[model samples]
Target: MAVNPPKIKVLLSANERLQKLKEAFHGKYKESPLFYACAPGRVNLIGEHIDYCGYAVLPMAIEQNILAAVSVNSSQTIQLANTDPKYKDFTVSVNEITIDRENPQWHYYFLCGVKGVQEQLGLSSMTGISCVVDGTIPASSGLSSSSALVCCAGLVTMEANQKTISKVLLAETCAKCERYIGTEGGGMDQSISFLAEEGTAKLIEFNPLRATDVKLPEGAVFVIANSCVEMNKAASSHFNIRVVECRIATKVLAKARGLEWSSLQKLGDLQTALGLSLEKMLDLVEEVLHPEPYSREEICKILGITTEQLSKNILSANTHHNLICRPCVS
Candidate 1:
């Protein structure tokens, strides 16, 4: 039997939070929003950083989300407002949309989603939108508030333009577009946000991303508690550094296995090429990689590649601060 996917509906009348958001939007814009789009924040239960290495991650949708009240019109500009007073209102001409990565303002993340959808659909001109964003996810909580906002915006844009796309397509597009704001994500957040079904967690895998329902133990309750300490993964280079380290590890391991190392860019790709189980992959990491860091010169010599090829083909935009690749560890 074909299973039914979870239904996501706009039930403002039944949801107090959504109702307040709608009222607030109507008060600001003087008209009721035509429709609403929402994307929930996700909690990664396991396989956190490994997702970028093209591994499967276990994540579940939380109650907190980013909700947008939207209306399509012929205003020729996009207007944005937030329910929270701290975030000031922003507006931009549809013809001249721009996102600034350095500032990382609240609205710029919203634009990342808008611009992503616009480019994906290849719309010469977009329907102008007046949107009010209301978010329950705490910012910088490691719970994917920014990604939820981006996903929500992508949904809003698609709806405003009267376009229809599959959840997988929307998830993939939103994942790629979020990098415009300097985040090197692995699609875990967007995938879980769109693919999550009520009453079950999901195992989200990438490289032709798909989600499978995971049954939880009976009587188990998952609770999310904020540490109150915030880390913006995009604002810092630590996340990218880890990604580059993994990429380097993949190439090195491929070379050790007599595979064409240059073509391999992810740990998961290497794992697939070797046809090894996860346990075997972990064993291989220990057998081939050293605890000490590898310099670029040593890596080049080991891989039989020149320094120029290493820089041109392997290094990421932010990984050039040093020539050392960190030790590989699970």
Candidate 2:
């Protein structure tokens, strides 16, 4: 049985935006869009960069989002056009979708989501699509614009294939597929984007992957200011380096406690094994993992794994450049 997504109520303002998107799609594709998919950008008010380590994140979807108007085609080719002229149009065969990490274009991010849903549904070939993507989120401003794009693409693909999926399932699939673009995120962005309810924030937890609504204080107004600078997390090695640091720290902590640490990839897994709270986990980090940077040889000695195994298993492509890993406890 095909599961249905949660009922979404579009307000007058959102309806106007959809109408504009529909008109834009017709202008570009010379045909009306069958349906529109939207995924909002997110703001992580408290948690930062810990989601990939299997930690809970408190996030909320912002008003800005990536919206896509799509129509299915019989051309066996996926055609993409952007409402923004800066992003050039792209078309590819249904069976040939390639996401380039080196030169990460706007279209490649959309393809990441489409390819993700395609792979998740086990479809060897996908139906051709004509899509016009529009977004208001500031690119690379740490507000999950890329993740929103991926989520939007995933939804478009699912609807185009005539498959129904729950918001939770779509969020999970989109999160996993985002790794195709070389950013190993913790899934909070996509989760809140899909699972968010209007007028409330969400406490997004991982591993089991659930969300609980968090009410805000009455009359509290939050403001977000962009620095007008951009950092592509996938293009840079900084984000992955932190992930590697945490992994090494987990293995070292696990090895110290006399628990088999090889299988422990997440700090949350270590916390579960020790039955420790977040405070206790911080205490454990100070006790076991030192502040000094750990070299490749030192980490290998502690984990009893060779340098080759370390590179293959623990370190990602970006982390290989930095052999000295620091435990980012503070």
Give the per-residue lDDT digits (tens) of candidate 2, residues 168-282. Answer: 8888999999888888877999999998877889999987789998998889898999999998888898777888888888889999999999899889889999999999998
Give the CA lDDT, 0 to 100, for residue 127 in model 1: 92
Clashes of 2: 0
The TM-scores of all predictions, comma-separated, are: 0.91, 0.94
lDDT of each: 0.86, 0.86
Over 1-330, each residue of candidate 1 has an lDDT whose tens digit, in order, gives 022223367566888987998899899999999988889999989897988889999999999999899888999899999999999999999899887876778888889998998999898999999999999999999999999999999998888888877888889889999888878888999889889878889999887888899988899998888889988876767777787788889988988899998888889999999999989999999999988878889988888888888777877555666666674844
How many backbone collisions does model 1 have?
0
Q: Pick the candidate with the highest TM-score.
A: 2
List the candidate 2 regions with Cα displacement exceeding 4 Å: 1-3, 6-16
Collision pairs in model 1: none
